[model samples]
Target: MVDKADKTAKVAPAKVKGGKKTSPAEFIRQVQTEGRKVVWPTWPETVRISIFVFIMMIILSLFFLGVDSAFGAVVSWLLTLA
Candidate 1:
């Protein structure tokens, strides 16, 4: 029979490649190197996307408001019949 305590015990972390841990300074250097490789969008592209998002938000809010008003009117009429 297996021991319940062994099943509940914490497992050790797996060893790194070549059993070497990365130093904090080396990690930061690697992060900066990766950051330099990132591509950023132009200002015009950012503005265009922002405008599109704002327009879609306004359109969706108007659509939901119309639907909610219609439903509210129907509920109010049904309550009047009771």
Candidate 2:
């Protein structure tokens, strides 16, 4: 089955006469049409997403800090024993 999105993704070659290139206006119009079809997130939704990601980063940072301190202490104790 052919999907609508896949169909829209394809573009045929522009017609050329006497080796002349296509105009920029046609290219910009095509891009704007495609841009309109995209779905964008709302500001409130974006803020919620940002907060969730920030919290996750803080949690992971604390975890790695604890693991690093434990390793450093063990290495210092082993050097003193030598």
Across residues 1-82, which tens digit of lDDT does each residue of candidate 2 receive? 9989997897877768656875799779979999999999999999999999999999999999999999999999999999
Look at candidate 2 and tell me the lDDT of residue 10. Answer: 70
Model 2, CA-based lDDT: 0.92
lDDT of candidate 1 over 1-82, digit per residue (tens): 9999999999989887778998999889999999999999899999999999999999999999999999999999999999
TM-score (C-alpha, index-matched) for candidate 1: 0.63
- Candidate with maximal TM-score: 1
lDDT of 1 at 20: 93
In model 2, the Cα lDDT at residue 48 comes to 97
TM-score of every prediction relative to native: 0.63, 0.57
lDDT over C-alpha atoms for residue 12 of model 2: 71
